[model samples]
Target: MFAFCADPKTLEGAAWFACYLTSATHLAMYWSVLTVMLLLALAAPSALMFGFGGALMARSHIPPLAWVGKGYISMVRGVPDIVFFLFVPIAVDQGLEYLMHVTRCADWTEPVRRGADFVVCPQAKIPQSTAPAYVHDAYAFALALLAFALVFGAFAANTLKGAMEAVPRAQVETAEAYGMNRAQAFRRIILPQMWVYALPGLTNLWMILVKATPLLFLLGIQDIVYWARELGGSKTQVYAYPHPDWRVWYFLALLVFYLGLTWASERVFARVQNRLSVGQATAAGEALRKAGAA
Candidate 1:
């Protein structure tokens, strides 16, 4: 970036360091931080959608729907998250391929399971073997996003369901007494009040989600952790700006990045909670009311 950076091989000290950090590979490395942030930003809302559906299903009047929702939430809770992180994408991928195979290869009678192998028609391959590199990367990212959403959604569903139930029975009863039906009471009374109760758990889930971004490396996504490992290793003299083993420093920078992310998220969530609590009967709202009067 600077005049001295014109000859990276001959430069030393701060000059070489500056040029090294500005290299194309390092630029991609920097961009990977944004990728992590984007993943979180996208995943949070998607997970909330999944959680809302799951929570609603759990509360469904239909016995089978309730069982499915309850089972989804409970099964995920007992399993190690890492296991699901690994399993979900592969399972989803294969399931998609299997459905495609059945439809696209209707005349074929080959069993999908041949011992350890999963055989499917070439047309059934996700992204297809002929697709470009970027398409493959996008496919992988989509799967990763789904895995994140599904895992976190289960936790969110449990929290939301509990929060829904925690809304006072008296409040719902009064709404009904005032001629509101179950659906009306839920929409006007229960849904509005549940946020305050759910905020604490949802905030904790956000922190967990932030920490879990590193696991993207395991899923073959070139996230910040992957870039750190790549750029922080020792470089040879053949490279323009050779360096020593700097993995420790790279990982340290990542640590700071995550710490800052969590700290900022905490501040934002706290502000949101305060805003949502205003005029509510919660302890925080009550306290705020008293303090404002004083």
Candidate 2:
């Protein structure tokens, strides 16, 4: 950024390093960090919503709805996540395209599936074939987000189902005795208490999600790992900055980044669990009350 950075080839040592770090590619790499953060920020809430819905579905009185919820959780838990990571995007993408094809390509007489290829009308293409780079990136990030949400949401559903079931039978009876209807009892007694039971499992899911960000590379997103590998790869004398393979150092930075994220997540979850445990009958609540008295 300095005036001397005008001619990077003439610079060496710290000056060369500073100019290199501030280059366009490096700036893109830095922005990719935010992309990871954006994914987490969006994915966490989306996954939670899906999980909540799934839990309620499984607990529903309707047999069909309960089957779907339990099936989703079972499918996720039974299968390896990488299978979903690889399959979900393709499935979702084609599903959208196929739906559009049926509507938009209704006049066309061509079959969508021939042999190994699945073809769709150009109009049915997501973002079309000629959209800007950012739109494509956004689309890919969205797919990755969906896959993460699906996998994590299934696990969350299981956690929440257990938590919901864990609410004491006596608690519900007591609420009913106090003239509370089923819905009122659920709102006042079940919903408020389930979090204390669910937090531990949910916290673990968050950490796994944090670590799982690296799998974005598999989903065609230019996440931090991709950038680190690209930037830290050795460049020859033909390039502006020639250096040895520094991927190890780049990966080390990623290590530090993930560690920091995990540590912060743990602290946040601990505080949440503590706050939720404040007045409950759980062991943790008792400990908190005793600590308060002391």
Most accurate candidate by lDDT: 2
Error of 1 at 178 (Å): 1.1
Query: Across residues 1-294, which tens digit of lDDT does each residue of candidate 2 receive?
Result: 678888778999999999999888889889999999998999889999999999999999999999999999999989999999999999999999999999998998889998999998899999787999999998998899999999999999999999998989899999999999988998999999999999999999998898899899999988899999998999998987789999999999999999998888999999999999999999999999999999
Task: State TM-scores per candidate.
Answer: 0.93, 0.96
lDDT for 238 (candidate 1) = 88
Model 1: weakest 10-residue lDDT segment is 1-10
Error of 2 at 259 (Å): 0.9
lDDT of 1 by residue, 1-294 (tens): 677777787888877778888888889888788878889999999999889889999999999999999999999988999999999999999999999998898887889899999989998888799999989988999999999999999999999999999899999999999999999999999999999999999999999999999999989888888888888899898888777999999999988998898999999999999998999889999988999999
- Model 2 stretches with alpha carbons more than 4 Å out: 1-3
- Which runs of model 1 end up more than 4 angstroms from their true locations? 1-7, 107-111
Worst 10 residues of 2 by lDDT: 1-10
- The numbered model that scores best in TM-score is 2
Clashes of each: 0, 0
* Residue 8, model 2, lDDT: 76
